[model samples]
Target chain A: MMTREKFEEAVLPPVVALLVAMLVGDALILLFGQSPGAVYRMLLEGTWGNAYGLGQVLYKATTLTFTGLAVAIGLRAGLFNIGAESQLAAGGFMAAVVGLAIPAGVPALLLLPVYFLAAALAGGAVGALPGWLKARFGAHEVITTIMLNFVVLALLNYLISSRFKVPDTLHTRELASGRLPRLDAFLPAFHGSAANVVLLLALAAAVLVGWFLFRTRAGFELRATGLQPAAAEYGGVKVGRVWWHAMAISGALAGIGGLNYVLGYKGYYEEGFATGAGFLGIAVALVGRSHPVGIVLAALLFATLSQGGLAVNALVPKQMVDVLQAVVIIAVATSVPEVRRLLRGFRRSNDA
Target chain B: MMALAFLTQTLRIAIPYLFAAAGGVMTERVGIIGLTLEGYMLGGAFGAAVGSLATGNPWIGLAAGALGGLVFALLYGLGAIRFRADQVVVGIAVNLLAIGLTRVLLRFLYDSSSNSPRVPGFNVTSSGSGFGALAQNPLVWMGFLALPLVAWILYRTPLGLRIRAVGEHPAAAISLGVPVTRVRWTAVALSGILAGLGGAYLALDQHQFTDQMTALRGFIALAATIFGRWDPKRVALACLLFAAAETLQIHLQGVGAFPSQFVEMIPYVLTIVALAGVVGRAVPPAALGRAPE
Candidate 1:
């Protein structure tokens, strides 16, 4: 668990960044002749004022949590898995395909495990490729992962469009046994929302990731490698293996994210269903300080901003929310240790 | 005639890549990661479309596009250089900001989300008359010239020497009185201008700016710069090579030789393979991505 000091340190930068980002959003709103106060009020009303909207926010937050963990693990291992966009898609696609392949007489109770394994393996394989390449050939994972995104997405596009696409739709055929019961099944308030069992699963994953990262020896080595690779190598940690396994697990987290939409909501793999979710994960992980508790909170905050984009669309374009998200990232990035040092120097020079 | 047609198509596709790749080479060579190339290009495209639409002149629009990129570059500089923020994260933010800003502006200014109204641009009288179509576009001519000019400035000028010194060893160069920060600022400005012009070319060529129209061209050009190991002449060659692969994709799609998406994957696959040391190892500048202490 994060000590109180660590928690405060982790929370402060993102909180300041959020404030600064909101100021930017205010300026943008004013420039467009809209009242920022009214827009924000409407945004709050649309998102948290009602149970239905809250349910949708939770649904979005659930996916963000998984992707956030995906990225957080990579960060802990000194890797940047920018390829989560395709990794998520690959997981969903593999699950869909495997789900369809199961014989009709198979027990429905066995389906979830099979689909989860299929998704994890698929996402893991794609994630491991860049890791292996970096380890074996000294290739920069940044460029390799970015390139892999295009390659994997293109390959998936080919499969869906030319081979597996349902007759008239852009998505593949529906899965036979991959559906997870929605929250609306039990809760009367979330009647029309997509919130499902996956939300609880996401919570469980967070606890598991936290425990594994903090309590396990493997997690300590991974964090050590991230902090100082040369020192960790001298200390007997297999740096290469940590990177590989961290990436595979990271990919698995993002792959499980795909289930929220594919199994929980849609029951099929639709092209471009979760277009910006993977990138949003970067924002989540960053604001969360790569910690589970922080990640969950950050995901909820972003989920509010995301769903609130639609809520405030009458006052401004939904894209304004995208602008705010980017601004938040910029502010958060500028609040890193390096920038703080620069700020201190600037102040000292001014005083001198 | 057939070969000429093929070459013209490649040249058309290569114009944007050439501009971005050349700019990326300058920025990367100066030791600042040019991850915002995409952002600059997108900003330029949006600027060109708005400028041309307002003024009814492609020349003014082109100038506006360059200015647009300069504006965004300053934003990036504030975060990445002045504040010494994480370059990679800020780069991603800049790109996202460009996309969001353009979309918002598109809706605000043009009342459309997908595209702006058709704007004034260079006239192409002969669609099928080979290079005649490209000959009239001043930006196209400038695009081809940009590579050699960058190469000359890098290899043949005093400023180039200073840039190399700063990139290779900023601390040593600072001791020698080379202004590291100023040199980086200059390189980033030039990168934004040239990459913006590259984006302006796309909007002007199409006579309209669409949201996020630069797509991944900026990335492809950046990849070219890396593939060429940050050498101007070689980077230009890499741009053309990737452009040829794209051209092949289009042609193969037309002929139905392979699935369209698979064909589109060719260039990206090539970049991955080339970066995998199938070609050779790459050594970045010593001071690359490091904030000056």
Candidate 2:
């Protein structure tokens, strides 16, 4: 367990960033001629005041958590897997296909695991290609991953619009099996919201990832390679292999992230379902300091902002939240080292 | 005849990529990674649309676009250069900022979310002269001129040598009395200006600014810069090649020869393949993406 001091050190930068972002947001709101306090009050009430609002927050948080973990894993391996958006889309598309085509006799419980595995495999395939290219050909993962996003999105669009379209719509048919149960069904407080069992799955995945990263030899190798490839190579670690494994695992996590949207709520693959979640994951990873618990808290914070944006959309431009989020990410990332130094100085003064 | 028609479309499409790639080459050459080209382009597009709509002049719109790009580059420089923030993170932040800022601005300016009203486009006169079609838009002519101009500036000037020198070894350049941050800021500003022009062309050509009008063209241009070995002339050639692919995709869509989505994927897939091929052969600037001490 982290001591109180350690927790404060870990959390201070993001909190400062968030506060700074809100100040900037308040200025923006004032520019738009709206009362920032009123808008903020509405946002707070909208997201946390009712069961439905709380449920929506959890639903969004579920997706954010998975994608955040995906980005965190990539960062661990020193790769910026911006293709998580595409990977999530691919995984969701594959899951939709499997869910739709599975035998009617198969139980939901059995098919759930199949959906998860298929999504991971599909996402992993795309992820590993970039990783292999980086390891083998010395191509930068950033450009390759970015290029793959466009390719995958176009592929998904083709598959859904032409091959698997439901008559005249831009979505696939609703799946017959492997649909996750709505959280409201089990917990009445989530009634009418899209919150589902995927929230639990996301939390479990986070714990699993934390355990793997801290306890596993493969994870250590991956981290070592990221920190110092020459040193890792000298230490006899297969750095290239670590790259492939890390990227594949990162992609798998993003693929499973699709479950929050496709299986949990939509029950079908739809156009633009994974929009912006992948990019927002970068913010979550940075704000959380690339830790599992930090990621969960960061995800929830962002989810609340998004959910609250909808609540105050009538009064102030909800786009303010986007500005705030960007500001927070930039502020935290840029100020963390300086903040750390400041804290150290204060500690030294106290010691003296 | 068919080839001529294809070539015309290719030239038209390649202009934006050429402009953006030229900017990207300069930025990377000056040892500053510019992933914010996408954001710069988006800002330029929005600025051009609003400017043209408000002023009824394409030239004013062009200036507005460049100004928009410069503004974004300044913000980026503030973070990446002044504060020593991570360039990659700053680039990503710029993109998100552009997207969000443009959307909000669009809502305020046009009272709509998806697109802006059509602005006056340049006149296309067909006088049956040989140069009639080519003279359709002055911007296209500008695109033709940009390649050589950038090449001359980058290859044949003292400033060019200094730019390259600062990129290669900033410490050495500083020792020689070169201001490293100023040079980088100038390069980034130039990148923004060119990318803004590219974005303005999209808006002025289409006669409207839609959300994300630049799409992934900025990134494609960045890829082109990489594929072309970061040389101005080669980057222009890569832009033309990618543009040819895009023109073919349009033609293919008309004939239903291939799935349109597959056609859409061609440029990106080719970029990936090209990047992989060039990794060993085309070396990046020695100090690319490194901050000057």
Candidate 3:
């Protein structure tokens, strides 16, 4: 009963809502006793004016890109993966341990792969617990994921404070021993930017994920399972396997975000280091409408907001940025009906 | 003596969770998952703190807290029920809004981020002998009483039937001339009231109003609701279980039995294990998360 034109009709509302939100956000700036035009200019300059600022934006984007992909994958499969936060924490913690534990003389080629693998495995394990429960026991992912989040937070708190306490500090040991070699020399151009070779890896993963979702038979099975589990089961798709695989992929992507954080920013993990990056990934996925390319753009937009928000802190409270973010999400969500009605009206007008 | 002390501590801690879980049961029973419990609880805490400080009366503070929660919950109901917004997203937004609003209000009211002026505690009744030492805050008794009251109201009353029917099959109920939206709205409002009371109790009874006062009790209440199979009595028992774990962690610290951090994790770890084990079989309200057509 659905058509491509109807799909387009559904999409238009969110886009219009976003544009309106930007305008309203600017208006909010003016109301807050700041010049909207000046603020916008500062935001642009802070996010992308200098090479360093642009690099920081890109670095932040790279982390968001991976986590956004993680959330998007789960959403596409009809699973709300709120567990991304915990999974990311687990992955980052595991990567930190592995990166720190390795002897100093290990080859970068081997060490990098090992650290990534460790991170992925840790994250995947956390994701699989909920996936298994959902598939086998009919447990809801939302509740399970949320409960797991508390468990992970408590566990991380214990680990960082006691077991893995880096000598005298509350943080882990610095990454002097097993640091991921900076891509500055290799790339030469994007120096001072954490936009490393990992971005390429993230891009490849995104392409592979896209291909798996759209072009492959398993991808079709996953989508079908998500659309209607009863129908998919009747049609002979392995519903359980799809849930597991989707969650595994989702968790791995989230883990990659953690790895990116460690490798790019602190070069070591600290307590509460990833600070809700996993949750922000949810906003990224939603704003992007769960598309790969859309998520990339959403991440960049969010990164810009993050940087710009800090820049404007001199004039307005930084909390206003969060308010704007929340407004954008609400506006986008509410736009669905308005956009649909507008399109219907437009078509009627055209017909008339 | 130690066991008695432990039991008393557990009951005291469980009271707030019991209140919030009861609210969750009411909303979920009407086919609406009440994720705004956190917001309501926090708002209640803030309202109670401010009201008690301004009026110098615990009861007034409690009423104010409940009112704050009711207002926020109504906003949530309007968005989710009237506008047909995504319930989960709206719930998360409400939680974020509550946090921001509370912070902003805190700054406006106290001019300090750390603590609010202490208010008078709720009056407590002392039992004669064996449990006299264990006699806790009056709100604990009120919370316990609410369990049976809620159960009776939910299962035995005509209003309860309507609420259940709305959750189970809203369209069918509507066809039968029931006001489905009204039932859902009322249920959500009631949820807010209960969560707000829980929050007020947290501030007035346990500790003075602090920013992190309601730390994750809202989520824990949600967990208890699911764990208890959305039944008032079972939810109360689940709250007791969590509270017992918390009490044990505290008691263990007194005896130097386990490290503080590890002991603190006991409740969370146990919750995950319990959820993985027991939650798989429990069926939620049939219409939960689905808007009425």
The TM-score leader among the candidates is 1
Taking all chains together, each candidate's TM-score versus the true structure is 0.96, 0.95, 0.89
lDDT, ranked from best to worst:
1, 2, 3
Q: How do the candidates score on chain B by TM-score?
A: 0.96, 0.94, 0.91
Ranking by TM-score: 1, 2, 3
Writing each residue's lDDT as its tens digit, candidate 2 over B74-100 gives 888887887777777778888888888
- For candidate 2, report its TM-score: 0.95
Off by over 4 Å in 1: A1-8, A103-108, A338-352
Q: Which parts of model 2 have CA positions greater than 4 angstroms off?
A: A1-9, A341-352, B123-136, B278-280
Q: Compute DockQ for each candidate against the true complex.
A: 0.77, 0.65, 0.36
> What TM-score describes the B chain of model 1?
0.96
- Give per-residue lDDT, candidate 3, residue A150: 77
Q: How does the DockQ of candidate 3 come out? A: 0.36
Tens digits of lDDT, candidate 3, B157-186: 988999999999988899999998888888
- Number of the top candidate by lDDT? 1
